[model samples]
Target: MLIAQITDLHVSFDPAFLDGRVAPLEAVLRAVAVLAALDPRPDAVLLTGDLAENGSAEEYAFIRHALGELDLPVFAVPGNHDSSPAMRTGLGSFMRASEASHACYVVDDFPLSLVGLDTSVAGKAHGALDPARLEWLEKVLGQRAGRPVFMFMHHPPFDTGIRTMDACGLLEGRERLAELIAWHGGVVGVVCGHVHRSIHTSVAGVPTVVAPSCAHQIALELRANAPLQYRLEPPAIALHRCEQGQMMVSHVRYIPDFPGPWRF
Candidate 1:
């Protein structure tokens, strides 16, 4: 099975642009155009989070319009910037719900089982795995034992060492999240966003990925005390291909918003 991933669109409706600085909706449009042109296409599109800059109703409506042009299933979760009620309404009947009545959900029955976790702590940039979310995950995994699942979320459970971003990464009780991964041998990988930079690491023997945003990215800083460094990097997305024997391979791909040629 093949899956396409886009994250951190941070779109704003009405084309007003957020804070008179970033054009989040334009980025979203560029990513959509690229995805729609993929050759083999994909079974679904996974949006990790930060769908809007302020989680406004209009923003969600804009998201709905953009995604309606796709031919595959679209799934998403609430980021720090997403409002659950608005997301549900705008997304309509396609937003897959987990066993919980919320946005977190699991799509089983494929070689690529998708486990979407909600780590958005309302009104805060930081994230946490609350008790309710933990219990729901435990139950879902317990029942789906032996099924390889690819978990996705807005807040990465691990850190990238980019001080400011790490401060917004999954906070306390991450060890518990690790334990869940450790116990679930069927877990193939954990995919996340919100860092706006592409990176990867292993969590409990599973490959975890941090997908870059569809807009500007954070500068590649490896320091432990770095501040926010927004760079005009190529907007990118991730593609995960599930191979034989339950193995999953992923690649970080960037599609230029416009036609260009590079001579090497």
Candidate 2:
């Protein structure tokens, strides 16, 4: 099974895109097009978070229409900039079936099970999962025991060494989450999207990936007290392919047209 991952779109309704030359919505559309043109289409698309710049109704609507171009199944969760209510209302039928209160859900139609955890905190940049949400995850994992689960969330559970982004990383309940993942041998990996750069690490012996944004990316700074900044780095997406015996392979693909496919 193959899963295509896109994250941190930051789509906006601003005509000039916050008075800048690049329009984020256009980048999102390009990403969708790239996904659509893949050699072997992915079984599903995982939209990690930060779908909108301001989490406004109009922004959600724009995202809804833009993502609609891809007919494949799309699973999503809210990011720091997303409004829970607005996403619930705007995404509507696009979201997988789940309890109404939280956006956490499961997509089991494919070979690999997808479990999305809502890490977005309303009006806050950091992420946290209260007891109730953790309980929900435990219950889901228990019920789906022995299945290869790909857990998706907006905030990464580990620090990226980028001081500014790590400052707003998953705050509370991270240790509990790590424990849950450690206990669940079936969890193939934990996928996230807040840092806006492709990063890889292991959490509880399971692979944890932070996919790059389809829009701009956070500057890569590995220093204490580094300034918070963004750069117009090449946009990217992640593709995960499940191999024999449940070994998952991931590739970071940049969405740029380069001269290629020429014979050696």
Best by TM-score: 2
TM-scores, one per candidate: 0.91, 0.93
Candidate 2 local Cα displacement, residue 161, angstroms: 0.3
lDDT of 2 at 152: 89
lDDT of 1 by residue, 1-264 (tens): 788899998886545553344567777888888889987998888899889777877888888889879867888977888887778777775467554445678887576678888888878898888878888888888888887788889998887888898888889557888898788778877889998888888888788888998876787888777668776577798998876576568888895853222111
Whole-model alpha-carbon lDDT for candidate 2:
0.85
- Under the 3 Å rule for N, CA and C atoms, how many clashes does model 1 have? 1
Residue pairs that clash (backbone atoms under 3 angstroms), model 2:
none
Query: Candidate 1: RMSD over Cα atoms?
Result: 3.5
**lDDT per model vs. reference:** 0.80, 0.85
Give Cα distance to truth, residue 19, candidate 2, Å: 4.1
What's the C-alpha lDDT at position 124 in model 2? 88
lDDT tens digits by residue: candidate 2, 173-211: 899998898777788878899999999998888888999
What overall lDDT, based on C-alpha atoms, would model 1 receive against the true structure?
0.80
TM-score of 1: 0.91
